[model samples]
Target: MIFLLLSIICSVTVGVLLKLAKRYQINVMQAVTWNYLFAIGLSLFFFKPDFSSVSFSLISPVYIALGILLPIIFLFQGFAVRQAGLAKTDIAQRLSLLISLCAAYFIFNENFDRLKYVGIIFGFVAIVLTMYKKQTSSNNKYSWLYLLLVFAGFGVIDILFKLVSQLNEIPYTTALFVIFCISFVLSLAYILYLAIAKKTKIQLINFVCGCILGLFNFGNILFYLKAHRAMAENPSTVFAAMNIGVIIIGSLIGILVFKERLSKWNYTGLVFALIAIVLITLSKLHAV
Candidate 1:
């Protein structure tokens, strides 16, 4: 429970940090590209994943896919947060939880009862609430498109991680470490391209921002891995907690810290989203 809570907190703070980074004039791709470089170091030190046990034939393809997907997802998320702000962006991203759950059910043969079904419906409601727009202007009109891309990218990333975990036949820690290594190599390639193209100046502060993002990201994933392992028997419940908790906490922080505001209708939608979260928690507790 404690690990689950901690993971949620870290996940929520990540958004706040990334949004703050934008205020520092950091471009999305540059910030995320450097983030992966630093993430490689932390993943190595903490997980220390050994490739010796992995069957190359089975894990190689998944690793490659993960390598490609990660940077794309991170880039999309950074753009989404930049355009939509953290509150709505996070709400959109949280929809991936439902996508992942559905994939796990049909593809992985996970089971859920009637109450869980109710929770899933609530989650869908939250998604609708998230996609709702409070104000529409020329600039912000297309914001939903960006957020949707973030949702799609995040869903694909989640499914890829699950597939990699299954194929590698290793703990989530090692699988994450492998993914990070591959992603690091890819990010380095991107950094080199940026350097050659002179797209933007890579300042020390940019690298430092990436390092900070990497550290928090490592902690977020680490706590999540621990929570998942500890609650392996109730993985769905943990997912439920983490997803809704991240949205609520993250949204609150965006409002309080960043002064994000929603319309009256969107505020009502936020209430529904909160109710959905309660339903999810109640369903999980009852299942237990």
Candidate 2:
């Protein structure tokens, strides 16, 4: 439970930090690039993944795809947090499980029960409602697009990671390390391109911010994995609690601390999101 709680806090804190980045005028790309550096270091230290026996020929394509996608999705997440409020961004991200569920049904040939179908329906409704923003001349008028990208991007990443997990050639942890290393190299290259083409100076502040962001980002993964190990017999409990906890906590922080306003429809959407998660969890439990 402690690991679960820490994971939730770390997940929400990543959003909070991204939110703060905008206010501080930090370059998100630089911060994100530096984030991968720290994440790579952390992965090496804790997981100590052995890649000597890894078969790059077999997993290179999947590894490369994930390598490219992780940093890109992370950048999208930062943009979404800046354009959309934390509440909406977090909801969209969490609800991305719907995409994974669909893939399971269609691609993986997994069966779903009535409750899961109902949950999927409510999840779609929640997305539409929560993303509704009143007409405003503000620059954030198109923020909903960023929210959508965040939702879809994460969903795709989830699918790819699931694919990686199905592989027998390499351990998941080792695959994670390789992916992170690749992400770092790619992100660094982009940062270098910006420096040369756009004359964007690599600032110390961005590095500092990136390191902090990486700490929370890695912590989120670390604690979530820890929670899973701690409750190996009750995986559903960790899944349900982590998702529900992030939504509730993120909404509160966005509304109260950040003063983000939500419409009545948005509030309704949030309620429905919780219901959707509960239904999905129940469906999983019933399946077991």
Candidate 3:
């Protein structure tokens, strides 16, 4: 539980820092690359895992493909955040939980009660509402296409996590290392493209941003792994608490600290999202 909370804090902090990085014109792709590099290194320190333990014979190509998609998602996420702003982008991304839930239901046969249904409904409403854009002289309206893509991309990523978790007896540390390797390779390719195109230069700011991002990125996975481990001990409470708590905390920081704005429709959407969250919480408590 402690780890999960720390992970949530780190996750929110990443969003804040990413937003700040825009001012430095940091190379988000390179930062993402370095983040994976650091994550791989960190996993090694914790797991001291042997390469022999990695059973290539048992691994699925589809599962490995999913791992590769993570960095691509990060690439899209950077654009989404830049274009849509923090609050809207995050709301869209979080709504991808619907995709994960459906995948869990069918693939993992995860069962839920009536309250979960209500929660899903509210979550859907929140997604729509949060995407509502108000025309302002100062700010460009949120792009619906960008929001949709962000949601879909992250939705698939979330489902991939569940799929990978179920596929092998791989330690979480090992799993992360594999994911980092895949993402790092892809990110390197992306950086090379940028360099060749002369779109931007990788400078000290990019490296510094990457270093900071790496710490949070590594912590995010570690804490998320801890959350899952904790869920094994107390499923309903831990899962519900972690998800809703992170969203609430992230949303609060986005709005108050960052002064991210939403239109009237967004407020309504947030209400629904909150209601959905409440339903999930209630369901968990009932199970307890």
Candidate 4:
């Protein structure tokens, strides 16, 4: 339970940090690039993932896909937080489970209960409502696209992760480490290109911000995995608690601390998101 609490805090903190980045004039791309460096360091220190047994040929495609997607989606998330606010951005991220659910049904041939179906329907509705903005400015309209991309990007990443987990030749930790390394190299290459071609000067503050982001990002994954291990018998509990806790906590912080405005429809969407998650959890429990 304590691990679950810590995981929730760390997850929400990532969004909070992204939100604060704009105020501090942090370069998100540079910060994200450095983030993978610190994440790789932490992964090596803690997981110590063994790669000797891994068949690189067998895992390369999925690994490369994940490596390409991780940093890109992370950047999208940062932009989404800056544009859409933490409350909606978090909800969009969590609702990405809907996409994964569909993939399970079609690609993986997994079955879902009626509750899950209803939940998926509600999840779509929530996405549409939560992304709704009152402003009619072209910039505001364009900004909301980031939220859509966040929703879709995380979904594809989730599906790819599931594919990685299914491969028996590679350990999950090893796969994670490799993906992080790949993301780091790609991000660094892009940053260097910007430096040389666009004359974008890298700053120390961005590195500092990235390191902090890396800590919370790694902490979130560590504690969530620990919580799952701690409650191995009740997997649905961990799933439900993680999603609900983040949505609730992130929304509170966005609205109260940041004073992010939300319409009546958006508030209703939040409630629907909660209900959808509960239903999906119930479906999982029923399957068990």
The C-alpha RMSD in Å for every predicted model, in order, reads 2.5, 1.1, 2.4, 1.2
Ranking by lDDT: 4, 2, 1, 3
TM-score of every prediction relative to native = 0.88, 0.97, 0.89, 0.97
Worst 10-residue lDDT window, candidate 1: 51-60
> In angstroms, how far off is 120's CA in candidate 3?
1.4
State the lDDT of candidate 1 residue by residue for 23-135, as single tens digits.
87876566676777787788778777776765555456777888888888777777767677888888777777667768878988877777667767876776676767755
- The weakest ten consecutive residues by lDDT in model 2 span 51-60
Number of clashing pairs per prediction, in order: 0, 0, 0, 0
Candidate 3 lDDT, 1-288, residue by residue in tens: 788788778777777677776777777888888877777788788767667767777556645776678777776767766666667666677678778777767877878899988888889888878877766643445466677888899888877776666666676456657777777887878788888897767776777788788889778777877787876766656655655665677677778877877678987876787677679778767766
lDDT of candidate 4 at residue 208, scale 0 to 100: 93
Candidate 3 has a TM-score of: 0.89
* Error of model 4, residue 165, in angstroms: 1.0
TM-score-better candidate, 3 vs 4: 4
Worst ten in a row by lDDT for model 4: 135-144
lDDT of 4 by residue, 1-288 (tens): 999999999999999999999999999999999999999999999999897866657566988999999899899999899888999999999999899999999999999889999999999999989998887665556657899998999899989988888877778888889999999999999999999999999999999999999999999989998999999999889989999999999999999999999999999999999999999999999999
